[model samples]
Target: MTQPFLSIRKLRKAFGAFTAVHDVTLDIPRGEFLTFLGPSGSGKSTTLYAIAGFQDPSSGNVLLEGKSLLAVPSHKRNIGMVFQRYTLFPHLSVAENVAFPLRVRRRPEAEVKRKVADMLGLVRLESFAERLPGALSGGQQQRVALARALAYDPPILLMDEPLSALDKKLREEIQAEIRRIHRETGVTILYVTHDQEEALHLSDRIALFRDGRIEQTGTGEDLYLRPATDFVAGFIGNSNFLAAEHLETKDGASTIRLADGSLISGINANGAFSSGQKTRLMIRPEAFRLERGPTSAELAVEIVDVAFYGERRRIVARTAAGQEIDIRPTSAAMASQEATPRHRRVFFDPGAAFLFPA
Candidate 1:
């Protein structure tokens, strides 16, 4: 097996008495896009800063291809970093900004020229090369930053919420550009962001950070469909957790009775559950079926509100116990069913629901 190109082992950080990161470890293979996703002040950025040499880790090691990067200065670490704010020199033109790294290294002038042109072209900013940073748009400025970061052809690239400052449309445009660059260059990338949609859309794998620690690390689907903890389920995607009472377990699945006294069996569970234990059932909004199907569990809910989305319809419902549940059924299904469900039975496969202790 090919060894990881970058390995983070037992990384930690602290400020005064407050610990910002705790024993965070991750292995990133060459050319893979890994994202550190979490809420604000959740230690994702702290971990990235450690890898970029912006801060010395309080403990543990950061290795690149078996070599430790500790004690190396940020500039000498040979890592590329694009920050939350575009740190471009306002006076420099796009091409010059892209060439800054090569110029710093004192490469031959001709080689530097060629690299600058290549970097601009890689970011699709060839036409904007002569424009100064002050004249460019937010997206364009960030593209220049990306070009500058990659001008050195570093083995790995680090992005710290590079698109956070842009508007929604511009953020998506740059996200597409970033994905294209990753595919074309195949440089390993470690990105940090609080945007769950961005992580799901861009990363090959994501390390979800909570307070001072990693909650889970896996593909978007892994974290979404089979979360290891309630935090993972709640963080990765939209999940509805309804209070339930555990009934029994058989084989790998367990049974639970919901707050409305509806019984659901064959539900997936993270750990063992005992009879009469208070628990919660996690069901994704998209998992509900408008019409009952095979091996389905039913819930009695009163439709509180409905809204149409492009692909699915958003339904706000209240259970018999007054617990709110969000359900998303495809538009076609909603159109075919009753126009307005005053109070109805919604069905979902028990296999798709997860049980966690309350």
Candidate 2:
């Protein structure tokens, strides 16, 4: 196999007695959009800062192609960075701000002008080129910052929660723009964000951080569907974890008994489980079926509440053991039913759910 384009080898960071990032290591392939996703102070941003040269790691190496980046200064590392705040020059016009990097590098005036115009067009900010930073909206300013970061065409780009400050609608809009730019430029991107949806939408792979360590790293679907741990299952999406007791496992399948004493077989047990071990079953809200199938685990539930969403209706139900779980059924599924059944039975495929140690 070829070498990784960017290799974070056992990266760690500490401040005084506190450890911010703990042995976090990952390999990023070329032209790959990898996201560092986690909550605040979860070491996501700290790990990104180490790669961007904004913060130094206490120990470990960040290798680009095969060279260590530890001794390189932030400016000389040839990495572009976009921050959460629009770090644009207040005095410079949008066009000039985008051209700042090339100017500092002392490129030819004609080449600088050409690259600046191209980057402005790439970010869809050519119309706002003449405006000052104060005159532009928050989203527009950030676009200019993006254009500036890519003006010199660095081999790698680092974005540190660049859209965190924007409103949801605007954040989504810029996210689309970023995805388009990544496709066009093919610059390897390492983006950091606390937003799970943003990470799912933008990244080719995600490294989920929790409390200074990496919980899991995989594609969005892998992390969501085949989660390595309960933290991954809970972090990637909305999940309803029902308590269960492990029965046995043969081959790759396992049997478990739910709290209500219903036996569920053929479930995906992602870990080793001894007989009668306590376990937790992970069932996504959309995994529950209102109708029974050939291979379905039936559950007796009391409908507590139902809310209508355009695409899907949300229903909250409680099992006989008083376990609250959420289920989402499409509007078409309920179109035939006259009224909400006070006592309802639901079914779910064991293959779609997971079992983890409690």
Candidate 3:
């Protein structure tokens, strides 16, 4: 097998007695976009800092194309970084911000000018080149910061919650720019963010962190559609988990008894389960259908409320067992008048359901 482009081999860090990052091992191919996703203090930022040479790992190593980067200083590592803050020099113009790195390396004057222009254009900030960062809006300043980070043509770029400061719409706008820049430049990116939507939108794969350790590493679909653990199911998207008791397993599917005494078979089981073991059945909110299918399981729920949001409708429902759950169905499929406060049978394919330990 070919060697990986970037490798984090059991990388770990500690702050005094408390460990911030557990041993994290991930192999990233060249030009691949990977995000470290988790809540605050879950070690995502700490791991990124290790790769950027800001914090030294207590054990293990970070290797780029088989060369250890553990001993390299932050500035000498030649890696680019964009932080939550813009981190642009207020005194410098947008063009100068992109030129600073080139100037530090003493690149020829002509080369610096050309590279600055290219980077600014790459981020679509060429029109604001002469403006200082203080004059630009938050989103524009971030674009300037992105341009500056990419100006030096670094092989790896590290971004730590770069869009966290922006509003939802602005975050989405810059996310598109970031994706476009990645495709255009083929730069390897290791981005850190707690936003699941951001990770799903930008990453080729994701490393989900929890309590200083990596919970799982896979493509967003893998975590969303076939989560390996209960935590993963809860974190990736909106899911309704009903309490159940495992009855039997065969051919990769399991039979479970729900709290309402409903027998649901053919549910996907994540791990080994003993008979009568308590577990939870996870079904995505979008998986529920108002109409029944041949292979679908039925749930009796009373519609508590339904709110329409453009193409989809958010439903608040209560199961027979008194569990309140969320169901989001497309507006085109569910009529607002039919979704009044009345008892209804919701259908979901058992094959699409997951069973996890309670």
Taking all chains together, each candidate's TM-score versus the true structure is 0.97, 0.98, 0.97
Give a tens-digit lDDT track for model 1, residues 190-287. 99999999999999999999997999999999999999889999988799999999999888799888776777889998888889999889999999
CA displacement after TM-score superposition, residue 170 of candidate 3 (Å):
1.4
Summarize candidate 2's per-residue lDDT along 151-214 as a digit string, tens digits. Answer: 9989999999999899999999999999999999999999999889999999999999999999
Model 3 residue 272 CA deviation (Å) reads: 0.5
| Residue pairs with clashing backbones, model 2 | none
Cα misplacement distance, residue 323 of candidate 3 (Å) = 0.8
Q: Could you tell me how far off, in angstroms, the CA of residue 178 lies in candidate 3 after the best superposition?
A: 0.5
Q: Pick the candidate with the highest TM-score.
A: 2
Q: Give the CA lDDT, 0 to 100, for residue 205 in model 1.
A: 97
Against the reference, the lDDT scores of all candidates come to: 0.92, 0.92, 0.93
List ranges where model 1 is wrong by over 4 Å.
none
Per-residue error (Å), model 2, residue 129: 1.7
